[model samples]
Target: MIVARELPVHPQASFFGAGPYPARRAAIAAAAVLAGFVLTAIWSAPFVDSVIGDSVANGLLGYDAKATPIGGVLAGTLFAFVSGLAGSFTACNIAAFGAVAPLVGGQAGEKRRFATTLKPLGWIAAGMLTVSVVYGVIVALVGTRMPQFSTAQTTRLSPRSVQSMIAFGVVGLVFLLLGLIALGLLRGPGFLRRHPAAPLVLMGALIGGFLIGRPYPLFRIMFRSAAEQHNVLYGAAAFALQSVGNIVVMAVLFLILTHATGGRVQRWLAAKPARIATVTGAALLVGGTFTLLYWDVRVLGRLGIIWFPMISW
Candidate 1:
């Protein structure tokens, strides 16, 4: 009689036991994102406004620019915490999808297929999240202190204000250019044909530059007319709400993109030989353009070269 021998378990089979069910993981990530949103709203509504008001008043009345810096630091810390929570939520979602892709796509016949996809997604999410949190914190710290740097009277457009606008406009142009370059690079032959990474990188750069530079002019214009506007508090709250809302919107968009791409992502990943050079080069170029725009605007404003147009409601 011939003895029957058990076959060795496949590596792909291990995935079924390695992580939590995909649905559960996705739900947990969603919950974390929601919780973070709630916490951010609470802190931003009253606490942040009060801090800003105090900081502004102290700086203006005592000519103590340091008060603004203190306020900025506090705001930055809060934003950093919120950004961290958002990053965690995003990461968990990416992991869940990665863990489930093989099962969902029915690719379990291939060894280590799921792990292969998940690893890169996990690393990319972690790196992007770290960068976002750091960026958010820096923005918050500097933003709160901005009002203190102005001249005593609000209505008159100071020479410094003009300088700021010119600087900001130049920076915006630079980011726009970089975004265009990224688009061109992505259209070139290579992994760009399959990966969405290039587009994402371009979007991030444009968004970052707009966030940092665009706001300065608008804020300056608003500051001048704030006395006539009774809704300064509301404006502050709206800004905070918008910031958190944008994150939620992006997460939803990512979900949609994932669903839309479906099995194509897996196929592309399996076929490509990890084109790191292409992805990294495109990302760095786009990111650097945004950074340049951000700093240039502030330097220009300080030099009194441009003035932001006031918005009338």
Candidate 2:
């Protein structure tokens, strides 16, 4: 019989003092958290483009993308928030969850209600919420200011429009490729394999980057349409609400981990990497396929070979 070898522990991997320089490791985690926000802010512009471009490149609602400003913004935020809940269970987020689970969940081995862990909970949740809100705002600010164009405008198959279609297709493939990584079918570069330690900025950035670039259907659906409209308020509001939802859901997970001691939840999370990868992978694959085929459907509609009813938002 073949025996499976256990993975050796890295000094940097231990959250508690079992490893050498435990204090420094904790400090590094804290620093990474803060650094995550800085990176998210710095990369906001390009991130926005990548996200919004994915939407625009896919078919958008045209004039309806701007339909009712007030209602749209409110609805967009609400919907995005709901969507974020589902989107949170990915590798990047799982890393974030694991990173802070020890601190927030505490050293207590007893499993208790989440209310008991409110002290550490407050700080961690607040910071996460704040960073997420900032990320949403940045995306909105950039998305609204981007050049005006729409799927409706691309009905004509001119050279410039053809080029645009090609770009969108390329991005769709990129999303698909990323989905493969999320699903564990592909490995990331070795350096990125390290679990983000604190000041948690890098962890936050990873979450932000994953959320922004993961080709989640909700993001592509909500932001893409909003980006085409150039509605700053809607864009910002939508992202803010989405972030709020994500933070709340993730906070609940943290609380569960902290209070439900004995590390049952954490261990379960760690043990099931294949399942997590599969779920996230499937979602991205479907989303990427939809994004890529958007133009093809639009072209077919333009040719009047197959007519489909427009979605009422």
Candidate 3:
């Protein structure tokens, strides 16, 4: 008979195992997320101003700013999806994703690793979606009660179409420039190339805050439509749908980039990070240019200039 030897297991090796260190880490992550939410709350009131501005602009243009249930949901879903995709490609997320990829894809086999990678990502997505929707609801409730924002009067909100148009044009230009930077066609900040080892929980909170933060001009525009309605539940539902759309896209990205079979692709992407960034940037540039052109045509038409085939979609 032969004696068999067993390998020794370290207590700190597994996060799920019983240990004070793992518990402490978990507590820290939770505290970090809560802190992020509190910071967002502090900025909520200022964001309401943007909401009012957007609503006034739409009303001046003879567009109904009040959001219907179905329309709000649809609009939220589309815009948030785009926002989430763009956010994921940002420096913070890219760094987090790169740091976690190896662990996600390092399981015993290809099939197992892919499945394992999705589990944590799904959890993070759910957490982000839940937190963001809660924040949206809070904004809707607080903004609706404010005296100035209670009514949807275009005159009260300000009927300056020129200013609004200029603002949109500027926004378009900024996105276009950022996109160019991503593509490497234009020089970008060097910090983007660095990968930081941030905790997953902290990253989740950051993502949640980004998607729902009222200070972000783009989100303020999207929220303004819902805010004009002054219905808390409706606004929350709209934002929830938006978060769902964002989460879905994030899941797909996780599936592709961190799967076990994606090692070769990952290596290729790593070797040409600038090239990948460039492609993403170009897409943003095209989108921004289109938006500017659309608005320019609309403004010119309003001024009695003849323009063929007005684009309203």
Q: Mind giving the per-residue lDDT tens digits that candidate 3 earns over 25-78?
A: 333333433432333223232233335434543444344433333255565555
The order by descending TM-score is: 2, 3, 1
Task: Report the C-alpha displacement of residue 4, candidate 1, in angstroms.
Answer: 23
Error of 3 at 45 (Å): 24
Ranking by lDDT: 2, 3, 1
TM-score to true structure, per model: 0.30, 0.41, 0.40
The window of 10 residues in a row where model 1 has the poorest summed lDDT is: 90-99
Say which prediction, candidate 1 or candidate 3, comes out ahead on TM-score: 3
Q: Against the correct fold, how does model 3 do in TM-score?
A: 0.40
Off by over 4 Å in 2: 1-71, 90-94, 109-116, 144-202, 225-233, 247-249, 260-313
lDDT of 1 by residue, 1-313 (tens): 9997533222222222221123333333334334333322222212222344334433433533323322333343343223322322221111112212222222222333434544433433443344344444443345544432456543445444444445445543433333223223222324433453443333333333222322232232323222223333433432333233224434444344334566454344334312112222223333333334333432343346554221222
lDDT of predicted model 2: 0.43
Q: Considering summed lDDT, which 10 consecutive residues are worst modelled in model 3?
A: 11-20
Identify the leading candidate in terms of lDDT: 2
